[model samples]
Target: MTLRSGAVTALLTATLIASTAATAASTPAAPRGEGAGVLRVSTSTPLTTAARLQAAGFDLVESRIGTDLLVVGDAAVRSRLGRMGYRVTVQQTAPTTERPVSTGRTNGIAAAAATFYGGYLTADEYVQHLSDVAAAHPDLAVTRDVGDSWRKTQGLATGNDLVAICLTKLQPGDCQLTPTSTKPRFLLIGAVHARELSATELSNRFVDLLANGYGTDAEVTSLLDSTEVWVVPVGNPDGREIVEQGTTSPYLQRKNANNSLGACAVPPTSSNQHGVDLNRNFTWKWGGTGTSTNPCDQTFRGSSAGSEPETVALSQLMTTLYPDQRGPLATDAAPLTTPGYMLTLHSYANMHVIPWGDTTTKAPNDAGLRSAAFRASYYNGYQTGQPGQILYTVTGSTDDYLYGERGVAASTMEVGPNSGSCTGFTPAYSCQDGFWTANKPAMMYLAKAARAPYQLSLGPTTTSVTAPTTTVTAGTTFTLTATGNDNAYGTSGVGKPTAQTVNAGRYFVDTAPWNGGTAVAMTANDGSWNSTSEVAKATVPTAGLTAGKHQLWVQTRDSSGNWGPATSAFVTVG
Candidate 1:
């Protein structure tokens, strides 16, 4: 989302023209120029201006709902907006030179993934990484070919097969498409816009964390044992390939590589590109606000709802993974026992975008959704709200579709800061580590919450769990301490969650409570669990345990009868 800054403007003269023609049969006239730049147009009615510019085939960089519109185009764009009687300023011009590519491997899971632009993985590399993970961790990971990308559907060799990886400790009914599976499912999709390079990297790291940290990391091991984590790292492979081919200045392609609709300019610029904005092509609330009928525009909703193959493939994958827990009404809330959570990762906004993205209306399960968002933000410190409240409105987005049609607790994570070295769609590779460090906890929290998102989100969280000694001899006793906080939710966003008293706390050995593990009561440090935060301690005996590591899971309950997600610490019997 970061653009190179420049000084450019034009005098007011011509009137604004609204163009609608966007097919192969007819082409609407537009302002022509040499290079693209980000233009900020001051308008009294920003939303109306955004709609007009989108309809006229302008790529919107960002819209400050009430202040101004950030449009991306060339000098002609600046002139056109200026002549339309609105004061326009150039924020940044597109970079002219290509970024240096890197071949250094930063992590072990996907060594081949580092052979792309500054360590970012290509679409093919991402799919190969999934295969590598599945091969390396056969017991815990499996790769599935979900569907074909748009190009592949068109019988083009340049297309890619949509691939996803499921990570969990395999059991009899695990990783199946049936909605009645025993384990809760968490789905993470990245790079839906194709140009958001960091999204795919974060997805890869999450996979690596779960697949590699299974035996050593207690928290990850417990999650893998009890929950199913699915990741589609390259959601728009065709568009990502187009982005990968940008050796001379990264091609800012925001959509899939489908070029049959409109006569978009050849050698796509930052602003003028041909393809459907896959985010706007979903079935729910399609062709609504913040979308364009113009095929060349960035937010183009295709010829029909779910017209693009990529959109259809993703929607189908969701349907296969989750059951419809909600009734067929916008006001019908998903039951508290809903067992799925979904997150679509984007870049540069640094916000947790919740459902009802097409409008300002609150979702049916607004409290639950807000609580979950606040919990995630507690780790990443990102702003949380509906799309219209933080970024501009977006229709037919992945979160809205999943939450609306499938009744899954879903949201979109806009990664990266608004202004920094790590900002924008194409950030420096070094920024990946820092971003991963900041977001890993949030990702883990969301994945764990997938088990009972609505109910668990309202309960007190196990902030920390620890064992006094890492290694213990067989037939010995050890002390385990855990801290629970009913106020762990983030307070930087709308709808502050009310904190309840920590009524009770308990621990289980080597098993999750949902799987019928026997719970052991823990005594609070202050002699009672009557406060918002409490430290509970338990004496665990290892008399019959074998000489190996065991997971000590801890959970806390609120006064409202809600048991929070479990956290774990490792204890090894020597």
Candidate 2:
């Protein structure tokens, strides 16, 4: 969703505001005395300092955090936050959640192409190839460094800055916060593993194909015109160079050029070369299983979390590109676990792995992850499961980190053109089209995942905290009471929903048994507007939908759009 510039900052944006504006006049006015005793206080004070005013001793019934409070029953707390520099309003707090669902988006894109031919360029050519592609499509493409990399790219991309490429047809002028963006930011990264050469080639080819299709192909042209496309062709540029220089034969180099692990580096560079595997260097499931410590071994987690410059650089980019969980720039204060679809390109095994990279156990939301993973992978001609479980467990993977830390849902796809040696990143050009035909759909799948606007979630307070995620049974009715709170519009003065929505009597799952089916989507309404959710499926397990920790959510709708009110929980499976 769009952020509010100038004096105010909105994360959920007015994406859902339109809904509230249209529906406020329609909500049957609350019963005379029902919830009438609740105190209402508004303030412009900072949220953290405003909490003290919400306690019962203070007689604070409902404390609204924002630019100015609309007072309901109490004027004391309002005045308190006000004396403390908060703008309080003594008005009735809305009985229900606001129709302010933010346009939650994923950093992925649909890479469906007409031919679906080819993978990425050579390891050495990965970056250059992307650069070349961007150059070729100057209108739709532009290159920028989101951040920096480690020593490998430090010299090349300027402190390892991400040499990112972006393509968009909408400008800030054309499509703005008014009607809300009909589009979202979609990301597709290739070569998280320096040696996964196919990813780089495939990503490059996808970009070129889209650029070429801008006017020629209908589907390609449509996607390009709709979403903002960003691609990181060579995630590990330095490693790629090493793989390329290692004799005429391309050796697999999964790590970055970080020599932190003294032994991780060795001479013959190609054969069993050393360095922290970039894949294993992320913050998620760090120092977990499926990782090695032989310095020379692959899948080695770095000395500590974020030890690599590459990892650090990417983290910085996330902070800058994405909203910050800290600082004056916080993008998503609530649990952003409602993930957009993501596809990370790897090599060899044709497996689509989901989250919980820390253990052999399935992720909390195994059902949702399983379904989306399978679907995305299926698009690309692959299978989906836990990376280690399906293929082998791994630690410090980028996908895990993105999902675990950033509230993003992502998957790793090991694209193999042929079954043999040619399958690695260096597959013969002859097999490119076959690889394209198989994986192009996966790219589309990710894009589709990203496009979904809303997500069912638990409390906005417990952000990224592990909860149950699984498939529900078909034709079965069940009450899932997992939810969180979010204030779509947050301001620096005295706004922002610091806490996730608490389980309310009328809105809780027990109060409202949501429709449980294969195609159950969700969104949020922050009382002012609403937004739609990503296309999340609530498939029921055949035997029955097992009980486990699950994300709680409410499906909301209004004139403007849909929003989310998801809950998080783990339960017993049947």
Candidate 3:
């Protein structure tokens, strides 16, 4: 499911030649949920290959820059591609069945009308669910119609409105679109590309879980009390309607139904062709590499940046809801001064991708971004990094736009298996439960992180040094004790933090003319310094001590790899 390559090759050759060389394999049901095999074409120029395949109608699943282009396609499509002189291989054969075994929900009798379809919800059902939750838990749940989708604004029969559900202990202006607020905020977007059924489903489940967890679950209760979570369960309603129309087999729809660019030039017929690729319609790096000029291409970049109403609305909402959290340009990282979190969910890739999708050059906040993403991958075990590194360089992507433009700590969660009976653009309903379970912890962690995403807040610190008056005998061993606290490894207020919660911490014995001293970590007499309390003690051996001033410095690192301010004890060993 997680593929990484390190080969280097010519960009031009990799792009033009690798398109046909890319192989699509059928998948067999595997216990690990790798539903089908993937077709891979090795390419150094992943951007070119990915774009070419997208234009050619192949679902460009993934791109391992130095290795190969992994796409999703069937036998007939592979045969056609093979005839085009590209190498073809049966990477994996799919099992006889590729559908989910169960619906994964026990809805009362009333659930039937909304659950008319096999495993997915009707557009109406999605809308009603939000309303129902708002009505039931008015205190903690509220719904806002951010804007109408393109189709809805244009009065198309397939149009559906865009909505967001906010779940927190509600207060005046708690979920309002504002740049400043008391609580840290998190935005979870789902189904930007309507065909990714699981994306929407998982978002829905998250909203329900949060709404239903109030008072009963202490952790959830604490999160709700402190953090504001906004869930856009469905981002592209028009495209979702088109996808819902396919009952026999899931529709292979990738773009919105915004047919303004003319006919659907790729595959699946003219009548079925829809709109721009919402993911590529953002304003940042709008028309760079990894996008298509052809309107029907899966990665179409729209006529102009922010052209689509869905794109416009989402961008506007972000600007209004979150003040610029980072500075401009790729050099700036999310600011610790005003940090917020945003995660846009997609399906089938199983990746936790950070920003700078347009290039591999590290983002200004690279350390913080990577730290947050790496921590998020703890539960699901997905590979985490920028698309340019893990997958392929993309422009105008949702994550890059949010992070690049507003300095928000934004990431994309490519949920579920990359290819399998339980994977693909849309996996079976039964597989929904697994994705939800795996991501539950990941989401909970993000909620906790929203609090101090940029800065590592330290707890009260205490320091002890051997010998009074800053003087000690030259031959005497000197003891230094430091203790601090942080919330990175545990939920801020829900339960007791323990050694298991802390990521890492250290004690440094700083000698005069000290650049940070290189030394072994200090030990705790009673295992004191850990996630729970972050305490450590170091004793400088008399053998290494000289007749000079020395200091003991201690700091604690949070789960995000951010170290809190250092605490120190001064001493002079003479």
- The candidate 3 region of ten consecutive residues with least summed lDDT is 1-10
lDDT of each residue in 1-574, candidate 3, tens digit only: 0000112113322432333133222322211111223465656666666656655655577433235666555554555567766675654443223322222224332434344235577556676688779899999988888887887778855566688888899988798877787777889898888778888888889888888988755447657867789888888877775654432344456678787777753223211245888898899989887777777656777899999999988888788778876666566566565567888889866778887888888778775566566655656777777787777777888888878888877888888765556766656678888898889877776766676554533322222323235578888776655554443332211112232234455656653112436645666546644454555666766566777765555655555455643444456777
Candidate 1, 128-174: lDDT as tens digits = 88888999999999988888888888987577888999999998888
Best by lDDT: 1
lDDT of 3 at 558: 50
Total backbone clashes of candidate 2, pairs 3 or more residues apart or in separate chains: 111
Q: Give each model a TM-score.
A: 0.88, 0.53, 0.71
lDDT of 2 by residue, 548-570 (tens): 33223333322222233222233
| Highest-scoring model, TM-score | 1
lDDT computed for candidate 1: 0.80
Error of 1 at 136 (Å): 1.0
